[model samples]
Every structure is written in structure tokens, then in C-alpha cells.
Target: MGGHFQGARERPNGPRQRDGECSRGAGRNRQIHRGLCSPSQFSTPRVECTPTRETPIARRCPDAPMRVAGQPQARSTVKSTVFVVVLVFSLIATGADAQRGPDTLGKIKAAKSINVAFSGDSLPFSYVGEGNKPAGYSIDLCQRVIAGIGQAVGEANLKVNWIVGTAAERVQMVATGKADMECANTTMTQTRLKDVDFSNLIFVDGGGFLVTVDAPINRFTDLNGKKIAVIKGTTTEVRLNAAMKARLVNAQVTTINDGSEGIALLTTGAVDAFAGDKIKLIGLAAQAKDPNKFAMLMEDLSYEPYAFALPRGDAAMRLEVNRALTKVYVSGDIEGIFAQWLGKLGRPSGLLAAMYLLNAIPE
Candidate 1:
């Protein structure tokens, strides 16, 4: 097997959130188990990226440090190669940027319309609602962010042009200033931090699998060599790839555009399982024709702290966004948003409550 996971900071358990905040639930502050819908399943996969066995293996000679022609890389070199491959991917991801404009808040003020990128199918967070209009927890938070921006920028009625895009498109859109903010359930990770900035932690989540009850997989070990489906351009994909690689799972992975396709694949038996944020999987499963047809693997593939992706280097705009979020947290408005969207799934966790108290800046 490959080397163990290193340098990954698991979102702590217990009162994992900051003090003065109420916990959304008792445990890791996972998604409310909402039968949440994510537009991710609805979109056409914008990009497909994965190594046949992962190029990192090639980048780092995991075999012998010095190998003869045609000789396999020695297992002794595996540990070092694991770190090297991870580092290389990190460098490459951060180095390539869209060269986003410097002043995101200024651009918004000048344009008189702050364009916020939102997912088209991200349920309970951001998604298309009645009449095809955008709605969800994150979308509402972005509206609140706009209110904070309007207050900061001296525009009481700043126009917010909702820009709907897929997960792959939203990061570049924000980094390039095509969108002022990505108001969706996007996890902030070291690789992505290279391209765009992130707001204060809004939601903490982890990976879960949705498999047909007929062939249920309760944990990671069962997924070995299984055919799995996940949407492209998501942290879920990255985590899944890394975890599978580290565990040396010879699983066949398929990428799709949206959650719907993933569900269809699971239903149609195109793949063995559909994997995503546990909350998102719950959302997909909830909406499935047979809610009882699917089972969620309790095992977590990785920790996901969801935040808004913003333009790089625009701390002011980020602060404005955070200030809006802080207001929401301070005023205890988040519970209502959660109720409005995710309440159907379950009650908010104590950890989620703590997230607001921790992130809310008194000053």
C-alpha cells in the first residue's frame, strides 16, 4: 500500500467549533443528513482529471531510488514518493492562476452589480428552485454577504447578479473576477487555496458513499476494487483519489457532470457506488425514487470545511463577505437559514452553532 496520509489536518472532533457558538449536532458537525440536492449532479462534467494509477507514482520513483531500465520501482521508495507526488500536485495547482483582478470589492462597486457564482444543483446550500430561480442556504448567505458589501461600499441597493456555474467553473470565475464570490458548498483545501481565497468556515463535512441497499458498503474496506461514481471538479474527487491511492484500492472510478447522473449510475448499476459529501449524498438519496433503496457508508474519506471561494488577494472583499457572515452568525440568523433549507433533513449540530460563534468577529 502507499504511505499513510500526512500533513492533512483533520477537522477536530468534540467542540470542534469555536466557543460561544451552538453546536449544530453532537459529533463532527456533519451535514444535517438532508436529502439535499446538489446541482453538481445536474451539470455536464466540465473537466475530467485522474491518473490511470495516478501520475504521482510516475512523478516520484516509488520503487528503488535508482532503478534499472524496465525494473519496477522498489517498495522502499514508496513513502518518499507519496510525499513528493502530493507536493508536486500542490505546487502545480497553486502556480497556475487566472490572474484575477486585484480589487474585487472595487469592481463590484463600479459595476453596480456584484456577480456571485452559485451552483445550479447544490441542494440546501445553493440550487435552482421554483421557476428555475436560484435558492438555497449558501445563496441566501451570499445575499446576506451582499447586504454586508452594500453596507461597506455605501450602496444600499447593490445589484447581485446571480451567476450559475458548475463546481469546476466557479473557482476560475471567482479567481478571474468573473464572479465576485462563489456562494456554494465548496470546501477550502491547500490545493484550492493556491488559486482562490476562502471565507471563514461556513460548514464542516466529510465524504460518504451512497450504494444500493442490495450491495451495501459499510466502510472503506468494502469499496476495494468497486466501481464508484463522483462528480468532477469537487473536493470529493480529490479526497477520494488520494484516499483510494493511499489505501491502494484498485477501484474503477467514473466522473460525471451532476449528482443526477451519479444517482442514475447507482440505480442502473453502471457503477458500484456514488460518493460525495455525506450531506449531498443524503440529499441525492432523499430525492431518489426509493429513499430506502440506498445506504450511506459511515466511514469518512476526508474532512471538508465548506467555505466561499473568493478572488485571490482581496482581503478587503473577503472581510466584507466575512462581516456579512459574522452578522448572520451573531444575530443567530443561521439557524433560520438552516431551518429554511436543511431543516427537513435534521436539526443543526452544536458544532455548526459553534462555527458561527467562533467566526463572528466582535470588532
Candidate 2:
């Protein structure tokens, strides 16, 4: 239930792009559905859902008898209430599906390479590693996905074209078939699912405040009037705003391009606090020139589930990615990855690992 997500801002080079942008399908502008893109608009263009039986209908009926035609008699009444509930729930589910991006798997296959988009800045999850190559948990997971594709196509060396992008462009890359997969710290939210598909939950993240060691704020409720730093187009922004609104708290929000810029602002005292995912904040803090100057508040505001994103139509691709993640979780590779990248502060507990294991599948 914890993760990171990027933004929706345009890149400097006109709009951020990968290999090439695909055309947008109708009803493709809604928020994500079920933590992925709309099923109708597949970023991969290679997947389709064949309907199957769902949960059994819960049935109820009126207990009271009514007189009809001037006669008192017991009559069986099939209540319309059940239908109403079903209709309402179905609409919710359908609305979620409508948010998914169109199928793009066919387009991706024709293009030959399975293009993957990722945030070039989210280190240890998706970032520039040695040789300026994309490396992190998501990157490694994608490598396994590439292996699956090689097995499918009988190409041992299936090529993976890595495209560096921002949070704003991640979905568009998949939605338009510019890239077939997204390997960033993406959160699973209903709004994002409408535009692209997400793989299994790769990591769990919680929202917290990042502040200078000397700052006075120590709790989620303490962010009043204080300029809080946040990234644009991310769940951190959405949830922080929502929490503030719900709690009747007010704070000035400053949107930055990346964590580095955000830390710069904090270091210069341009803002009172930096708000983001705890893991990411810790990463930034560890790499800071003087790590002792900042600390993450222990109190959390929300939990988010991070997952890999793909175009909605590519169920095969989604499944393949999920399978690889499952292997990582079951094989204990995820633990190792966390240790290598995030375990310095503290090793993830049995509870957190159990949660990851239980909800390993994509929503």
C-alpha cells in the first residue's frame, strides 16, 4: 500500500517522447482505472480481455407481504434493490475500465522492440546506473520481462529500448505506444489506471514529511502555512492536498521537477518542508552532500502501492511483467534489492514483506 508516482507536466523538448508517440484513442483522457490504464486503450496494443464469470450476485427480498386486488395474500417480491446495487457497482467498475488506455501490443510487436519508459531520476527504483543505463528494482524486473518475451518470441536476445522520461510522460509513452512498459516509482490509483496498465505491486511506500533537521514540524498536522515541497503530477501531490483539505489545514505547495531540485530548495530554506515518499526521501537524504542536515518524520499521512505501468490492452505483457515480479517476491530477490538500495536505515519488517507477498498481483 505504499509507493511513488510521477507527474503530468510536459518535458522541455516540446512534449516528452520516447521512440515515437502513438495516436490517442477515444475516452483515453480519464484518470487511471484499477491502478492501471483503461483497458480499451492499450499502450502495448497487444492485449484483450475475454470476459469470465465474476463474484456471485448477493440476493435479498422483501419480507413483508402486501394485499393486492383487494385480497390479503402472501406474494413473493423480487426486490429491485439488488439490481440497483448491482447497477451502481457495475458503473463504478465500468468507469474504471473506461479509464484504461487502448491496446498497443500489436503496434509494439510490429515495432520489434518493447520500448520501456522510466523516470530518469528515481534512483534505486528507476534511474541512471553505470554506463548511463537505466537500473533499479523496476529495471531489473523489466529485464526479467524481457526474458519472458524472448521465451515467447524465441529470441534469446530480445532487445529492450529504454527511454528516459519524466513522470508526466510515463503514461503517454505507454498510452500512445511510444513505450510498451513503464519502470518508475508509479503508484496504483484509480485515476492512473484509466490511461495505462500497471504490473503487480513492486514496492510499498508511505507518505511523510522531509524537513531540515532543525525544522520544528514533526507531524502530519504541523504543515500549516509552511511551504511544503512536492513534485508535480504525482500521488504525493494528490494525497497531500486531499489530506490537507480533509483536515482543514493550509500550506503553500511548491512543485519541483525532481528530488535534486527539491532538496536544493530545502537546503536553501526556500521551503519549510519537503513532502514525498519516505523511501525516496531517505534515498535523497543519504546522497545529500551533508546527510546529517535532514530527517524524515516518522508520522505518515497515507500508504501507496507502487507498480510497473504498461498500456492497458497488453494483458499478455502485463501478465508477463507480473510473473517476473512474483518470482522476485517469492525468490527473495525483492528483499535483496531493498537491502542493496533501501535497507541502510532499517530492513523491511516481516509485516511489510507479508503485505507485499499477499498483494503481489496487480489490481
What lDDT does each candidate get? 0.77, 0.72
TM-scores, all candidates, are 0.70, 0.68
TM match of model 1 to true structure:
0.70
Report the lDDT tens digits of candidate 1 across residue range 217-283. Answer: 7778788979999999898998899989898888999999998899899998999998898888887
Any runs in candidate 2 off by more than 4 Å, and if so which? 1-110, 359-363
Top candidate by TM-score: 1
Clashes of 2: 45
- List candidate 1 stretches off by more than 4 Å: 1-101
- 1-363 in candidate 2: lDDT tens per residue? 133233343323333222222222333233221222334545554222222322111211133232223121221122344555677799889988876535444455555667888877786678887898888767777787778666665566666788888776887787777887888888888888888778877778888888998988888778788899998888899998999999888999999889999899999999989888887788787778998999889988789788888777667677667777776777777777777776665878666777677855544
Q: Listing every candidate in turn, what is its Cα RMSD in Å to the true structure after a full C-alpha superposition?
A: 32.4, 26.8
Candidate 1 residue 23 Cα shift, in angstroms, is 92
